[model samples]
Target: MHKNKNIKAITSFPALKGRLKQLTLCALSGALLLSVSACSEQASQTPEQAKADFEAAYNSISTERLKNDIRVLSSDEFEGRLPTTEGETKTLDFLTAGFTEAGFKPGNGDSFFQQVDLMQITADPDMTLRIGENEFVYKVNMVASSKREVPSIELSESPIVFLGYGVNAPEYDWNDYDQVDVSGKTVIVLVNDPGFAAADSGKFQGSTMTYYGRWSYKYEEASRQGADAVFIVHETAPASYGWSVVANSWSGPQYGLVSPDQGQSRVKVEGWLSRDAAIKVFADAGLDFDQEKEKALQGPYSQALDLSASVTVNNSIEKSKSYNVFASLPGSELPDEHIIYTAHWDHLGKDETKDGDQIYNGAHDNATGTAAIIEMARAFASLEVAPKRTISMLVVTAEEQGLLGSKYYAENPIIPLDKTVANINMDAMNILGPTKDVSVVGMGKSELESYLEKAATNQGRVLTQEDRPEAGYYYRSDHFSFAKLGVPALYAKGGSQPINDEIAQYRKRMNVIVTGCYHQVCDQFRETWNFEGITEDTQLLFEVGYDLANTSDWPQWNATSEFQR
Candidate 1:
């Protein structure tokens, strides 16, 4: 059973001002100050005094507090914390109170909420895809949806073209759509990049998937090629998950930022086809899937199959507002420069069609990360004096919906990209016991990783790369939004190595949780789950951000990184 804390109602502007005034009379005030005497006092402290001050603040991150917050947020009453719903309202209120309690002022001007206007399109499940004489059912062999905010979208026997991986990377000198006009046609693409298929060190980054391998890039490139519809053939090993992940993720109400032309710039239809169904389609065209894939690895490949695809998507569209919640511990000296921490605050909402459990309580998926941010705020607030640069915490919405909220923030930023020092993102935190090593997602992307390594070293833990680099977990999260725009972003957590031999059992359980319950209804808060690992990871991130905030240095992306400015 979960217990919801009876948090006080959100403080009004006048009351908030009074609270700030009262806090200013005390040490380490919550209010943002440009030139406070407390800054001088903090600067005057000896090294020993400063270390004691840091320890006091760092030790304030309580595992019990994090556990309770996750329990409350992931409870059924939150309705899976979906954006633009009653769940969103409750989540906003809860976060507003949490930020207030943590002594953080609104990062956005006079408001904690940054309203992100979105177009929500829920597609009808009762749809069919016809490939010549063969027919495939929705959620069975195929899952497709239209980004275009229209009542219905249809394709009538559009010519099908196999466009290899559908990647147009100029740096790699690879373009599958080269000399091929896919205008007004449907295209079939393979998941991941040719690097994974070829397994050759010279191709792309060998097994390490690049941004070109992402499905979003595929859809975007197809749109640029004027393709009416595009479908990626899904394979479990390359895509890193089962067909259920695609089916469950795409079947829901999809959200995109409100566009001027109602997403007309995007392809009319985009989705995935099960590998089995794709093989059948290839066979129908008198082609073998394995043989074609092998040929695709050699170089650019495209062929006009003798099949035509026809499908229609009936969508229920609603124009509404979701929010990116922001709260900050402003700097005393360099208020303009900011060190931002981000975590997504959304998950798959309730599904009425399911038998008993319908809510996707995304406890491990994000609740742990969100809770850690709130705790980090408290740690910052407990400092003897504010950091030199502002510490901003942003909890974005609709991350489960293709990172819409963060994308909106990145495109329309409150803090200028040039002024932003670094972005530390937390997602799906470790819930098993502590580990001897910390894992860096998309390692070697930026210099911000060095700070993480230093922090991990202080904790007696080493740094390691993610076990599954081929999964492309980097592009799948909110940090990718910042990285794409040149800001250095770090996403790391407890690596797989257990702290001691006694915790081997927890590691086995973690594997089961990550593989079995991801994006499913079973992703609920478990009482047996350990919070020590998440707590340590939170502290490590806090140390990194805290160090960055106090220093004048701005970490940049590695020269070899694709996201380099």
Candidate 2:
């Protein structure tokens, strides 16, 4: 996203400066006039007339095709579509072929791929957490990873400190690092902010889990404090996930963008310890973990513990190039302005260390979302008229790896951000059936909500905001990357309505997938999935985009939105 550049006036005389200023104002006014005229012309288009053929093309999106795509993508052949793997090549080829078949042209200078450089780090730690003389085994007691650039980590007898939430928000008049000389030591931090612990939503964005609550923040704060290592004590409730989810995700091939300084500014190691392990470690230093934790969060408090630990990590690093797939339908009027659709095409690759089924197929996790976008692309191509603004479908990689692909695109957008109208991001859409309501995550943040609501209403559906704000879903998806740059984005899922009357059934199925199959090898394609829901969800997306396309009105973030310019 390019920032606005200031233009200076050229003056040859004392009176010329004022005259030049007048001329510049006139030019700017003329430009504004042209822009407003164009906007009015486009915004005046009859929605009913423009969308007359929209339903037809949207109907052309076949349930069978979507199902077939998901089936293959989540199958054993693609190897979970991990970035920088054989599976990546196959996935990219599949998306490109689909785009070609759907009347889309190559978006990146006659190439469908935009190369993204990424680095993979797998930590094989010969680690032991020693509290005085008592030693605990790694992985079982604690699992560690690193963002540092080095190949290995060695920290022996580093003293420990307990910092509640590990937040340093001067705005909130709080600093956990206050009165601490933490140089070259380790910091033991809590998982989430006090908002969750206090069961008070009014505290720290009201149980919404501010950025300070994230474990990544803990590590970064520790680094800023010049700590050698950071270990976050994990509690399922505050973390909003089970410890196994942490173990599975952090233990394998961890990834990060190629840092400019090769991550030298980062702490040597970052990890998590189970509550029991944390208790034992604290107790070994003649302190009770639970009691200390209560005091730590009491404000204006921090403790330099007598506890010390040591570990050594041997890392296997691999650097490679992956891609974000861009397929475009050139605009009939405004070729430079764009409406972007993004879905991640990558999932966690096969974990051979697992027993039998090794691949984390990510069927409902994201394969379904990727398939939906392809079907949407096909639908847009089948439309009677080309959109007024370019419509691009982007299948990004490494979303499961903490939104790496999307972050890269945000930093290096193929198109200028100011010219980009809006982004529609789909991840793990509804596979249950049709619904009377459509769900929008971060619903109130932008004008796109009105567009989405109108489109959903036309289809006899209501709009629903995210039910669980505590999960902080708006910050977790690829859409956040665009939103952070002040681009109006709608991050949606199929949650508002379900066709089936058995209310408990949908939740049961979803819970089973979430708790058991999410990020696990069991997330394979299922024969029982009903694609009608996702198909309808895709239709809603198409209609909303159609509404945006015929109108030149650029959506803007609401005044209350954090990303508002």
Candidate 3:
């Protein structure tokens, strides 16, 4: 359904030779002197030209178009764009049509749609938990479900094991599962790390949350160890958010890629237990939760309690088809190599609770990101000179469903991973006015930082590292899907500056926006939004892509980065 004219590939010359050739050609044609004279004459008019050009392009960006897209995507009509639903069909059709109108070729050779088979699981709350004669109510304590359809295995009634942080980090010399055979037992693990609960707070990353602390890693590690069920005790401070957030998150329709071969590489059941419910389990096991917390802060500790817990989980898994929309502008030269721009088009569909509004429009969370991708595609298409390397624009699905769309693409890439230069991901963009700095979330992880620095400098803007690395934002977005495979990714945000007052005021404003409207339905397009930041950010993004597209060199991970080996 998506198609664009395939432009002829261009030959890539060495950077220095390319510049020299252009200069020589200009000089031989006597255009260099004329260009210089014209530049001198139009010196004062350059700013006007730049402003006019940018405004014209910016004006072409229809807020109405964005609203139209958001209204449909978020409306009750789309049913929240859930995968495999009518919503998904409508969403994909809209994106496919948009890409076609934007003049992009089918990214996957001849297909605009990348088929991602998925399994949709809906859990029944009536499942019972039984440990020997002791039984606990499932609804109040935990919610369990499996990705597998016919995973025939009895609930393990073996003793529960408390694996400190449940991490296997070689760098930190930490292994919670060390010397323990948790073959078929349930593992009760702490949400975050010891450093998060430490008194000094400067020990490990100190509340900054290492990868070991993430719930995803915990689940993955447990599943790898062949644990029957992994229960992560949720706490506000250590987990970085309240249990209500977790409850709401897990209650949603869960999604995962359907194995092409239908082979099983996933756990039977994985779920979370409320902190209060976990405390009751510990109490029944004659283990003190407070004591464990206090001792864990003091030093390393691991224990396998003889307390055996069992549960019978009944869930239905259905196979469904989700889509990843791909569109690209072919390179003039080195078309095999690619530079990918990604943004997720999915959000938490409709939630009836928490302020009466049912639609999670996600206008700012991702609608802005999706809109930005379209605009970028248009800009790249408008360029007179095609990029040297292929430019792939990927608007993925189900980002709100735990980065499933991006994850599938990363694992089964249409283009080989080795030829992929770098992934530039746009999540929530700044709808506020422009600032003087641009913030890189996972800064110093790759050579992409250098490229961004160059782009920022060109725009008279400064590049900054994230002020709050403790947020672990690097691991939260779709970029992490690429990063996990050693692909370099850059997740940058619009920066903040003291436009009229102290920098603290600017930061406060940013925090309010992030915490308040970030995931809420109120993230709608506003007339008061100054597109200065969007314009500057988009231009910087273009420059980054341009540098990558023009050069033949591949971007590498920084030497000190853990991903680089």
Please name the candidate that would achieve the greatest TM-score relative to the true structure.
Answer: 1
Give the clash count for each candidate. Answer: 0, 1, 3
lDDT of 2 by residue, 1-565 (tens): 0000111122222221222111110124444532221122333336685656676786798999999999988989988777766777778778877877777777777677787777778888566666578776667878877887788877788888887778887655668888887888888899887767666534555566655677767887889889899999988888888888777667866777888898889988888999888888888778888898788667746777787878887887767677898888877688788999999998877777778887878898789999999998888887666777888888897787778888898888998888889999999888666777787776677899899888788778888877876666787889888987788989876775565676447656765665656666778888777788888888889888877886889988886554664
User: What are the per-residue Cα lDDT tens digits for candidate 3 across 1-565?
Assistant: 0001111122321221222111110133444333221011223335466445444543455545554554455566664555555556666766766766666777876667686666656666666666435565554666666666553434766668877677766655567777888887888888877767772765556656656677888888888887777878888877777766766566534666676544245555677777777777777778888787676555556776778876665555666566788888777667788999998877656554557766656667676777778777766665444566888899887677678889999999988899999999998776665677898986778999889998888767788877766556788888888988888998986886634454446557655755666556666555445545665677678778868976898889876454665
Top lDDT: which candidate number? Answer: 1
Every candidate's lDDT: 0.85, 0.77, 0.68
lDDT of 1 at 52: 83
Identify the superior model by lDDT, candidate 2 or candidate 3: 2
Task: Give the per-residue lDDT digits (tens) of candidate 1, residues 505-529.
Answer: 8778766866778777899999988
Task: Flag regions of model 1 displaced more than 4 Å.
Answer: 1-49, 132-135, 276-287, 306-308, 349-359, 506-515, 520-522
Order the candidate numbers by lDDT, best to worst.
1, 2, 3
Which one wins by lDDT: 1 or 3?
A: 1
Per-model TM against the reference: 0.87, 0.80, 0.80
Q: How does residue 212 of candidate 1 score in lDDT?
A: 85
Error of 2 at 83 (Å): 3.2
Quote the lDDT for 288 in model 2.
88
